[model samples]
Target: MPVSSENKNGPYKPQPIKKVSTTTVVNPGFFAYTNLTGCQPYYCAEQVHLINNITVTALTIIIRVQKTSAATYHGVANNFWTGYINSNHTDNGSQIIYTFVLDPTQTVVASTTWYVEAQMDLYGTSQVTSADTYTVSVTGGGITNSYSGHF
Candidate 1:
């Protein structure tokens, strides 16, 4: 038997429609470095900006160190640090972008910043040495994050 049209208890009911809007933001990336002796300490810092999108709530910053010089005695070690910036709203993974730190530890002090120096020579022919520092600051609207690196 067919149900009466006056029945208020319908199996299928329609719901109200909803509307949504979206916008995208872009960020900038940069890098810088200095030369020094093997034993000397060095320090450098730079400011980076992180742009947030609707999907990402935070941005992760990763710092990596590479030996641009082939001095054999100068190899990079202990080269990784992590920091983050927040987006105004939640966002997908793709919305997050990374800005690397040049030096996070502040290990390289003034005058002592050297490219190469002689060691006690306990194990190998020579020991390689390097140092780095890093810091993160957010502008407009975002979370605060920071990390350091030494190598």
Candidate 2:
């Protein structure tokens, strides 16, 4: 039997359109403590606020210390000394907001031992006799924040 070309095409049905979504990481909100003083044993203590909606695997904290130009202190480093936060901690994604102190005298507090280390010795040697200033910057979750302090 021979087939005819006419009426050879089959009926077509309309297909539903599918939607596509793209996921991207969002930056978190950061609030720094502007007023910090190193009067307590040559170490300044302050808390930083972070509002995150996504997981932050690695966070970097940088602290830079420098003696003020008007400072007449000796036996201390007059230049900028930088410190970093080198640790393995992951911030889970959530709607909850948390704050942490930059320097803590005790490692464990209320069973939660999370704190940043910005010791005066890390900045320089001896005591900070005269006025000194420090700048701390934190970077994580695609955002960066910074603040200044004095002693």
| lDDT, candidate 2, 29-85, per-residue tens | 332222232434334322221222333333433333343222221111111112222
Model 2 weakest lDDT span, ten residues long:
72-81
Residue-level lDDT for 17 in candidate 1? 14
Index of the highest-lDDT prediction: 2
Model 1 residue 82 CA deviation (Å) reads 15
**TM-score against truth, every candidate:** 0.18, 0.29
The local lDDT score (0 to 100) that residue 6 gets in candidate 2 is 21
- RMSD (CA, angstroms), candidate 1: 25.2
| Candidate 2 backbone clash number | 0
